[model samples]
Target: MRKNLLANVLDTPSEPRTDYARRGASRSMRMSIDEMAENAKRMIDGEVIVSLDPSLIDASFVSDRLTDDEVEFAQLKAAIEAHGQATPILVRPIENGRYMVVFGHRRLRAARELGRPVKAVVRQLEEIAHILAQGQENTARANLSFIEKALFAQKLLAMGQSKATIKSALTLDDTLLSRMLSVVETIPPPVLEAIGAARTVGRDRWEELKKLLAHPAKAALAAEVIQSDVFLSKEGAERFTHLCAQVKSGRRAARKPAEPERWSGEGIQARFRKSGKTFSLSLSSADAGEFGAYLAAQLGQLYDAFKKEKAR
Candidate 1:
């Protein structure tokens, strides 16, 4: 069944070429010979482009994007209004003559807002094929952020899809698939939704957040921060940054400063303080400067010895 679905997605017909000649009276509306040939090829391949009422189309079963960019959507609506839709969206038929979008969600949305028929290529696809087509199209476009892809993978997993199938759909390797799953699993859903497709936030930043949120207290703090009016007012990237900062600051404020350990031998005294992956050492003696320099110089050798001891 998976093989058949894979083949179906791979062998699906391409979007039909728009008929520029019939678009308008402007010179830009003239179809070049190349475009005409492309349209002829599409016809030969038995591809049909149809206009559907935007009201009849529904979103995909699993959403890939966290939130819509209203500014971008408005721009898309304007473009379609001024120049008409340049390319048709891909959709699969559902019950009662309704359709579910496979890709081209923005185009469908633009058409809907403009109160016009959406140009689309309808294909009959099973669940797996529908997911593959949608994932691959967005992956190719490179518009989805790392977190959005992770959320999509999470949704696919929730649907009982295998990791192999999810990886294939998103063109992700095993390591990346694991990382994506880990991130989604570690972060609270409400926080992720509130962040809303931090378009500028990449994997490293997300991983950092994941580690921070792994602690239940920090995760709870993040949830509270995201609900604040200050956090809500910020945009995508800002929201992510604000959440991270709030969580980190809360963790720091809640932690008590570690007491310093003091050691005295002969005329030398030493103090050491440790706090969450950072440590400080202070020495006071006649040879303190010389001893500190010696220790610094021996760090490499000491680290090697530490590793050897740890292995045992």
Candidate 2:
């Protein structure tokens, strides 16, 4: 149930409005007195202030993981290196002159990894509010994962926002929001933790997952499928969805008779498991290696048998 502290998007609101409005191309615009004052304070503190004080800020909180898509990552990394930080990271002061990172995580990571000094505007707030604000602000701008967004929405709900309010805050399309909400409803705590741990699961998969919960063991089976790399990648995540449907239809057909796999060496292997109308063929990497050979031999024999029977 523990979260990876290092993967947190913000220890406080990551992209606080001031954090963006005061920096980059927008810096040219006129500002209110508070903005002017903050700017003056920063200049006075020296152009390059070292406030690594992580007191009010949460450095332990991690930025979201970078996507594996190389092109986009390359573009982002290059842009940050060339332009320096176009957006000021949000931070809050801590007790012993420390600061926590709230937003601008991409910039922060780039700076840290590249040995560039990070530019930030240190803001301050209470710890609980800071934590709450952290999720609230970033979820607005970031395309958070289904679980991340839902869990964040739940957090807001705990903070006394109604579902309608949370919906508005998230700005999801109605159909999209409805589907996601159903997922949060069916998934239990342990599964939730798995979901939070970068597991590739969400609304689409949940429609199938929900079915299994009606029969707990099968639900557990579906969960195992989710945790499998082969199924996850090969068939796409919707594999579980289809598998669930198959299980349901198969279970219903159990009361009726069904065709049998003919007895033979490869056919025996193909008849690994059959329940009701649903059946399964067991396979292995080694077996898969020889599958084409096995299929050709077995199917050829069946064809030859049919030809002789017709001739007679």
Candidate 3:
């Protein structure tokens, strides 16, 4: 990768990027580009004209925040100073003359940091609905965090969207939509924020963890289990959930006043299943005395009918 980038740096006529080999790269430094048409320029040198035509752009940034380290920001700024913006950023027009970045936030920030006018390839988005454009943009570029999407869906829902409309707005399937909404609805705010961290936890797995928190005590158990990476790994969280369920079951069993004789024939069969999600119960009773009175009443009625016939 270094050799190929270095070669591109040396071959391009615009300027030798002193920092290209070390600190930063052109947006063409993108590692993959499977979605583009064959003719799209995956790479270019300092000489390529990176222009921003307002007619060809849209507004809105998918990644609204930058990391604390700002390593990408520093590297991007250095690269922009040396090579200029080789690739124009994707953007859409906003309220003022300014445009909102659609995809290249790092590049845009870096350009500003370097005090260079950012170059961006503008695409006209007049016909596309805002939410659809946002969804399409997300779908095309990268995956979203489950929580990020959950929040997005909730925002859309609050904006008067029907369930179907919200699903369409996010371009998510029924199962995913249901799960996302479940997370938003169920997970407590602080715990949800902790799970939203980009490093250790994941949205799908974290959402499952939230379900375990439905019972307050179990929720506290989950909170303790998820406080650190060793405890929050998928395997760890699952085990903790299982343990929580087990303890809960034990507590419930202890709380029960024992089954009545009707269901006690088999004596309360209870066992956990393999998936830890299902259980079974079977009861058989042999008590003729429970029906003794009914049998006697029927016999008495028959005898009375017989006496009436005899009288007749």
Candidate 4:
């Protein structure tokens, strides 16, 4: 099922680009033929475009934006102002006939700013499909940075979408999804936002950051650094480096482990110990081996219950 969905996403049709001269499209509507064709094909395969009131559009579904690029945003605004909106955004209808954007935030922003009607394609989509369309569209455009994509994956999970749904949306395998989620879940949103997309940064560096932040003191320092003027002055990769340096500057030795927890009831006794993120459980006494075997056999059931608990 996921394979089919992914294939459909990859082959999604696009809207054909209208000729500027023929359509009286703005001179600012500058795009290569190949780009235009690709956009058109994608639109054709995806959905039909229609002009709608900008006031009726909402950006509430946006969860992946890391930062706003003023200059780039201005350029987009200018193009839209001059040529009118060329490409339509995707939207899902809401209650009372309102619509929420699934993607094309910049275009939506420009439309709102210009006080003109925005072009959009309205589709009925479930949460997973909505996110998948957003991710795949931005991916094809090479717009979303690594961290932004990671954050989007995190957002999907927070919304109670399963890991499998996230994988399908982002086109990530288990290993990559694990790495991405690790960074997004561990690093605070404010810190990630301050770092601002860090387009050149990759998984390894983010993994390093995740480890550095494992220390509460370093994590606190990082939180402070992200808000500092010095941190704000830097761009993308530099911003990430600056924060990393501050967090790594003075590391302390690891703390001693806490005493193992003890539990006893009836003829059973159990010991639980924690070291960092890992935990261990052990049984002792005459029936200890047999009890351990029983527990081990029930591990699958335990895990299923844990998953159900988490889902709730």
Candidate 5:
């Protein structure tokens, strides 16, 4: 039988005693930094595994993972019921004699629902260290999809974690981290949530979707697609594909572009239209037309000013 485990708190620095002499006083202070580093390493290593009643541990305040689907949760619960929880979650003690989870939220939920004790490793962790362990563990497990990881990166940034810290926590290089952040930041959060995690979708597809969504009217259409019954019927990856296809088709339909909008004020009239990279404006009516001619004659000066304004 596995024995019940107990937590051992790491030692903290103590005040230097005068009887020991002044020579050793600075030695303890110098060890402080090294000691802190060691403690953090121990926290990540999960040095102690203890069992706690599920009710005593609170879920992480900001979960790093998306909500598990009912079918997935049921499968996990069944496996744990049969084999017992094979993995121990990591947690930190919090106020009111409770603990906050650092990772393994799905296991925690299963244990809670089953009314069983959850095996966990209790560690004293700074917030950054906790998140770093949490992210790295998930990455190693290979359970999070690409977009899920992107959203996690976005959440870490929102919580004010430095870019360096986030890169370290996710075990990503600068370029990959930049791509993840860009994808998450470009896609609207609600739309992402609605589509769920696109397990089969990768970074490049999402980038393409972002570019397609830049159309001024595509946002409202994308929002409607997620809410439609058709969208909900499909699996996560399918849902993402469906929305992208619809939006891209919508862009094609808009390619013809509409005629110029006409405006009239004070007996002066103008027509404005944009085609590809070019814009055209046609002026008419008695007063404004002649003013338009005079303005046209100064095109050289106007073009110079426009170029200077763009530089500024």
Candidate 6:
């Protein structure tokens, strides 16, 4: 049974971490570097497990999850009550003989609620290794949403970690790491905290929100929606959807339509219309094609002149 449980935790195939294990374990363990690293990997891989007082354990310095899922926590507590904890959490010794969790926060929470000692593996990891281990474990689980990962990356950056370290920790490429940072930087922290984890919301939807919030008017609307009773009543992804809808609706309501005007000159007829920031020019007549081609060709110069004027 213990073997089966360990198999469940380590069953997911991951890249061999012999090098990382060696570096992380060399300081504290008395064994040879190679042996210590192997044992460290095995311990994290669930070869050894021990029960620790949940009350004696503290949270990691940085948090990856934005909010608690009460329903899921209840379900997890029930499962542990029935079959016992299948996997052990990872922790490192801190001052006063207390320990700090590296990952499996939900499991620890469940164990605490059940009034039972939590199953955990103790290791001696420096702060960098601790962050990497926590992030990689969650990444392997594939449970965190895009926004959650983005926020996690944001927090790591605020801690002065390098982009490469953040990428390695979260398993992100350069492009993805850039986008995640952009998302968190663009969206206000209060808005993100209010929306919670948004587990169902994905990258594209978040990008859309970022674009909308770029507009000052839409951003204001979002701020209002997040504060309102209706939006506050919603949860998780629903909050994100509600805020998006309110911002869009506010934009539509705020748009002002101008009267269309017609012009006929030099054997060409044209109509000009304006709505909010969008403007349109329609050309008609036999020479319209020639005139339109001319306009398209000069658009770059025209835009440059407009920018100069706006700057003035």
Clash statistics: count for each candidate: 0, 18, 11, 12, 0, 0
**What digit string (tens of lDDT, one per residue) describes model 1 on residues 141-181?**
84899999999999999999998889989999999999998
Q: How far off is model 3, as Cα RMSD? A: 22.0
Tens digit of per-residue lDDT, candidate 2, span 144-210: 6666666656665566656665666566666766676666667665555533423365566666666
Clashes of 1: 0
| Model 1 lDDT-worst window of ten | 21-30
| Candidate 3 lDDT, 1-312, residue by residue in tens | 999999999888985567664354544554334334322543321222245543333335333221322554577678778877766666655766666666565666666566556776554454235556565565555355556667767766766767776677577788988887787777666555544424234665656556666768876554554454443454423543444454355333122123332333243322222323643333333544444445467987888999999999
Question: Over the stretch 251-294, how does candidate 6's per-residue lDDT look in tens digits?
Answer: 43233346789998887788998777888999988878887899
- lDDT of each prediction vs. the true structure? 0.88, 0.57, 0.56, 0.82, 0.82, 0.87
TM per candidate: 0.66, 0.48, 0.45, 0.63, 0.65, 0.66
Question: Which candidate number has the best lDDT?
Answer: 1
- If candidate 6 were superposed on the true structure by all CA atoms, what would the RMSD be? 22.3
RMSD of each candidate? 21.0, 17.9, 22.0, 22.5, 19.5, 22.3
lDDT digits (tens) for residues 78-172 of candidate 4? 99999988888999898788988888888998998999889998888877788888877877774777788898888878888888878877778
What TM-score, to 2 decimals, does candidate 6 have? Answer: 0.66
Instruction: Give the better candidate number (2 or 6) by lDDT.
Output: 6
Which residues of candidate 5, in runs, are more than 4 Å off? 1-46, 251-312
Error of 6 at 254 (Å): 15
Ranked by TM-score, the better of candidates 1 and 4 is: 1
Q: What is the descending TM-score order?
A: 1, 6, 5, 4, 2, 3
lDDT per residue (tens digit) for residues 67-182 in model 5: 57778889999999999999999899898989999888889999999999999999888898888888899888847888888888888899898999888878899999999888
Clashing pairs in 5: none
Choose 5 or 6, whichever is better by TM-score: 6
Scanning candidate 4 in windows of ten residues, the lowest lDDT window is 22-31
